[model samples]
Target: MAVITTKGVEKVYNPDKIPVKALKGVDLEIEAGEFTAIVGPSGSGKTTLLNIIGGLDRPTAGYVEVGGEDISQMSDNALIDFRKEHIGFVFQAYNLIPVLTARENVEFVMLLQNRSKAERHARADELLKAVGLEDKVHKRPAELSGGQQQRVAVARALAPKPTFILADEPTANLDSESTANLLDIMARLNQEEGVTFVFSTHDQRVIDRARRVVTLVDGKVDEDLRR
Candidate 1:
């Protein structure tokens, strides 16, 4: 099943002023459980496309369907709620709360959903273990290594049981070993738990691990190769 679908997607910034066309007519589909990488040069609109698909930003024109819902047509508040329920985001910056422990950070999203305290704690523990951070559960972001912090970020993203994960340069800050470990964890999750992942990355390490590579150039899909 196609978990994510984009048709004729376009993004234009400052349309009334100096317009910057970030994306132009992008058509793509990502099936469930696929490990896909959206790769391109700096100006290739990879981030723009990811943002649109993830509902973080709306497109100038196009249709975006995530988990079969037309997110492009949703209101800002609606989009926000939709994202919380369906999309998981992992940024390059390991955006964890500096004050919260790994377990607390993982429970944050479920808290937003008004989940029971017991449910929240249980899920957090389960995810922290899944990411190999069971021992670091009580540690704060500042107390963990860069790799461990990213692992916590992953666990947090997965806390909501999102339909798919959208990661933007998730390995940009990690060392080689950290990147490898993170990738191994993600690949295992995809295979073992049937998680779906879509990444916008420039790292060759990430590209090498992706089962499908979609290349974009000058705001359009230049090549799409599936391994």
Candidate 2:
């Protein structure tokens, strides 16, 4: 079964006014354990697609199914719960809580899920170690470099062991070396842990690492290439 599936997805903004269509009948299916990238020039609706798949936005038409469940019809609260349990997100900005330490940041989601303190601690430690942030577990976001913070974000995103990860322009703020390091860690996780990752990125570095590339143009799919 596909980890994520979209059929005839469409989105429109300001329907009462300008009605700018963001997605025009998009259809896609992402299998489990696939490392895929969605690429397009500006205003091509890549982010819109990712947001719909991530459950942050609802499509105006069609459906989105994650792990065989149709999410387009879910209530807002249901979607929130569904996202918490199934989808991991890494944004261009680190989005770490400034006051929380790296370990705390990683544990926050588990805490929300009402996991026991011991379980949260153990999982946070393991994920931090997995992301190569073992030594900086106690550092706050302000104390870490941009790359370090992004690494912590990755660790936090993985803490829940979500079915798949959604990353949006994740390498945009990093230097070459940091981007390489982050990509290496993600690749390792994808290979060794069989984690599925879908990214919307413009960076060539990220595009180079993707095993499959889906290109969008003028709110529609233009190309889907598997390498």
Cα RMSD of all models vs. native, in order, equals: 0.8, 0.7
Reference-based TM-score, model 2? 0.98
In angstroms, how far off is 63's CA in candidate 1? 1.3
lDDT of 1 at 104: 95
**TM-scores, in order shown?**
0.98, 0.98
Task: Give the lowest summed-lDDT range of ten residues in model 2.
Answer: 152-161
lDDT of 1 by residue, 93-184 (tens): 99999999999999998999999999999999998998888899899999999899999999988999999999999999999999999999
Model 1 is weakest, by summed lDDT over 10 consecutive residues, at: 83-92
After superposing all C-alphas onto the true structure, candidate 2 shows an RMSD in angstroms of: 0.7
Scored against the true structure, residue 45 in model 1 reaches a CA lDDT of: 98
| Model 2 stretches astray by more than 4 angstroms | none
Which residue pairs overlap in candidate 1's backbone? none
Q: Give the TM-score of candidate 1.
A: 0.98
RMSD of 1: 0.8
Could you give candidate 2's per-residue lDDT for residues 59-123 as a string of tens digits? 99999999999999999999989988998899999999999999999999888899999999999
